[model samples]
Target chain A: MNLLLLEDADFVAADRAILRDRRLHHLQEVHRAQAGDTLRVGRLDGAMGQGELLRLDAGEAELRLTLDRPPPAKLPLTLLLALPRPKMLRRVLQTVAAMGVPRLVLLNSYRVEKSFWQTPFLEPAAIREQLVLGLEQARDTRLPEVLIEPRFKPFVEDRLPALAAGSLGLLGHPGEHPPCPRAVEGPVTLAIGPEGGWIPYEVEKLAAAGLAPVQLGERILRVETAVTALLARLF
Target chain B: MNLLLLEDADFVAADRAILRDRRLHHLQEVHRAQAGDTLRVGRLDGAMGQGELLRLDAGEAELRLTLDRPPPAKLPLTLLLALPRPKMLRRVLQTVAAMGVPRLVLLNSYRVEKSFWQTPFLEPAAIREQLVLGLEQARDTRLPEVLIEPRFKPFVEDRLPALAAGSLGLLGHPGEHPPCPRAVEGPVTLAIGPEGGWIPYEVEKLAAAGLAPVQLGERILRVETAVTALLARLF
Candidate 1:
């Protein structure tokens, strides 16, 4: 684990960071980390540092934090993603967080099932949990700010244009468009559709908001693969 | 299965291309497909088609291939992936195929364990099997081409530069750089690292070979998550 995250205020106040979380369990059970094992640590949405284990128990562990290193930078990109199935949502959140996209706009789409948005996994804590797992995997400390847009039209017509400024933007569509370019060295906002993809009207609306519709290939990728492929190519 | 894929010869004078090969087993055992059920079918390296019931035997089944439409386009992108563990290798191949990346080059890296090269999944038929699953998921027919390179330096220094031409070339690293752009358009040749990521010297080599060392964030993502994230940004 890169960042041994701590949430308990008591430990943070005592100049101590506790590994008494699910992560600690992971280290103990999966990694089998020993005391003085020097785990990489971070405070949520804060700085990154190291944690030297001092004590341990079945449920809790204590360590001292040493913030000497700066956290890695985040992507200057914001995601306008259609809410995905719960299981896929968990993976998407974790992957997005791990990749360090600073913001996410989980919007509604035509093909999206109404029930998908109601999934309990969409709750902030659950989202936070997935982000934590992603951050830990990437050895990062800062958490991306996630936003939800229950209404697609209002968000696209009213808010998206404003957010498009200084941002290289595009819409992921399996239609007529050149292939996606590599990192263009600036802020970017990308919008991806639900399972079947953005309806033509949705694509047109996003285009009006300065998001260009781009094709990945002839084959239709699953939402997850398309998301990953788009991010990787942009990188 | 959304598509039942077959070889060209498996067509012309062949049965329904019901994929009696292992796919039939997949249908019978995994999907529990019955005689009358219709399934998606495609000619390998060709367009998507459909199949219907005919006759069945202990080892084989015969049906009619009625091809009415062409498969979706193959992804113009190519993936230069560092071989992952076999367990991950299985799913990744399927996902990449589904993404419609027409070509893949799995190379060795410093972080790659020697044992991973010996995985049974490296067998040709085994790999093709995974690709088929990916095509079925996306309802596409084209099969992706996979290439394996055990040597890193020769492949990167000699073969990759020309291969990456006219393509957005990216090297995924965890360091300082501009954020990954969204909906990158154009031909793309993406390079990703092995489990522990490319060592500094290797990253430098890629940089020397015209790869732009890009960061997803401060966080280090798992290979699978990284792949997914990268694709999302690129598309």
Candidate 2:
């Protein structure tokens, strides 16, 4: 973990926290941290700063916290992803959270197998676990909001236009379309398709909803890689 | 698999190929491919074309191949990366190949765990397996050349200069350095550091060899994410 993330439940006082969970294991093993060592830390949805290890034992480690600096700014993005397969879903969640996406809409596509929606990984707790891992990896605090849309048509036809209204609406499709824009200023609403990509009809629906198609060349990248690549290029 | 990759051994004749491996299982299971089905196929380090499934059985599947199109062009870049942990190494190898990176150098760094170099994942066959998966993912037909440098100083001081000569040499570091450049028309040589980043002395050595540092803002990304982000932005 790049940053030792502390939740409210771990706090004993405003400036003191006790960690006895996996964080403690990470401290003892991965970090090989000792008492009196200082660690970079951040509170969930709060500020980031330093923590001085006060007491260390097998049961728990207490640290005096001093959270001051604000978390890093999130991307001006509202990502719409065709829910990936369960195995890929977990990694994509972590990638999205780590890359600073402010919001995510896991929408269905015609190609998205119905079984994917039944995965345990989509559970809030499971999703939050992956996001927390991402926050720890990127040293950020706030979690990105995740919205699930099982019905593609309703979400695209009813809610998408409003969500995409003021943003630079884009569809990360593969075709003879214009290249994905670079270093775009202001907000973006980007929809990325499933493995086989968006069906022609779905692309038209998204286009009608304000998201124009954009390509990233011929090579097909995995969903996680595409997410990072697109976010990096856009921001 | 987006493209059915055929090795030389898979060929029974100049135009006919038989598959009795994972590819066969994929055809039967994932693709639900049957006799008379036509699928996208690519020859190893050769051409891409359509394969007409002539026969399908539990033991084997036969395809009549007609190869024509050239694979996607590789990136005009050589990536230098500090060897990541084994699990990440596999994924990064896949990422490098999928993104069309033509060459890669897995170099030693101060922060790189010595155990990383000892991983079986570093074996040529193991590496090739991952790269092949990447090529299959992207529908590409060529594998990237991988070079390993266990010694950091000599490789950086003696060899990097010649390798970086006439190219846009850049070090993907996190600091007050200028933002990484984009859309360059020429070749590039990029060096990305390990988890904790390159130590000061290593950075200076790399600088002397021609790679100046560049930043991707404040948020720290994982090694794989950083690779994709940097490649996407630069290209």
Candidate 3:
């Protein structure tokens, strides 16, 4: 548990901030927090502080906190990824968020199988859960904005331009090309393919749209690996 | 398992191969293979083959195999990484092998916590097990060789020139002035950092030893991400 994040309303009471359900569960199970114990806590849109557990019970807990300052400014990076397998999608979202990319655009691609779109795991709440895990890992309070585009053409032709504005855009593919640039200034937009990878036509289209076809090397990486690798090198 | 991996000894008799233990468990549980099922199989140092289940039972299973052609060539690159956290290490080794980087050098780095060296997962057999998963994922039978360097300085200075022979050696770091190149030919040796990333002095020593400090981008990626990203762009 990096930081215990709470909502604005949850922090409203002056006497003691009472956490009854999820927070209490976290305290007991994840943190193994006890009475008089201090856990790293953060308020919504507020600074990070320690929460002193004044009292604890099976169901609820009361904490006395001292909020100080907010988290580090998040990097201005947008990840444009093809929707992956359901379980993998969750990992990707959480991992991306944890890495400090503020925005994620889950787009469509050619190699993406048809069944992926039908998964119930695509629900916004499920995606949120993954994002929350990401936030917890990085100790960041701000939730990254996630956008889904089931249609490939519309996303790339219409929405991607504005998002790529003032950004260094790069596409990851495995080929004998230049390595993906390091230290790109301004906002950055990175495109990664699906399991089987972006077909030649799709690569051409992306290249025509100003996304450079850059590679890390000759090895073919999984989707999750490619995304994480791009963020690591670019950020 | 993406690809069913078999060994020369696995081909017991002229026409029959008996699969028992873990492979049988996977065939039963994961693949749900029944009698008459055919699976893609690879022979160690031999060729990709087809396995036809001739009989099945709790004790062992009999398979009729048809050996054909060699597995795909491994990716034309090599990787040298700082030993990451054990949890991340499993994924790193697995993914690297899956991508077909035939060799791995797990070196020590400045940000690599001292305690990490104590992990039981660092054992050769344990590390090779993880690489097997990657090989299975890629459907390739040849296992990647793994090397360990518990000490950082001596390895980078003494053994680097020989290991890096005929191969471009690059170090992936976040802070260095310029960015890393995207793609290059011939064999390559890539050195990545741990979770906390590479300390400056460590990067300089490698750079002075004919290694190039390549940047992925402005964002700091986790060690796992950095390795994959550098491999994608550099190899």
Candidate number of the best DockQ: 2
How large a fraction of the reference contact set does each model reproduce?
0.88, 0.89, 0.28
Candidate 1 chain B least-lDDT 10 residues: B11-20
Residue-wise lDDT of candidate 1 within A1-235, one digit each (tens)? 5667666563655468665567778889966887778877777767777778887779878788886777778878999999998999998887787777889899999988899989999999999999888888777777888899989899999999999888888998876798877756888899989877888888889999999988776666666676767777776
Against the reference, the lDDT scores of all candidates come to: 0.79, 0.96, 0.77
What DockQ, between 0 and 1, does each candidate earn?
A: 0.47, 0.90, 0.23
Where does candidate 2 chain A have its weakest 10-residue lDDT segment? A226-235
In TM-score terms, which candidate is top? 2
DockQ of 3: 0.23
- List model 3 lDDT by residue over A1-235, tens digit each: 5677777767647525888877789889867888999887776545677789998899788889887767657777888888899889987887787777788888888878889999888898888878776666666777888898998887787778777877777888877778887656778788898876788887877776678888865445567776766765665
Instruction: Order the numbered candidates by lDDT, best leading.
Output: 2, 1, 3
- TM-score, prediction 3: 0.67
Per residue, candidate 2 scores C-alpha lDDT tens digits across A144-211 of: 99999999999999999999999999999988999999999999999999999999999999999999
lDDT of 2 by residue, B94-119 (tens): 99999999999999999999999999
Please give the C-alpha DockQ score of model 1: 0.47
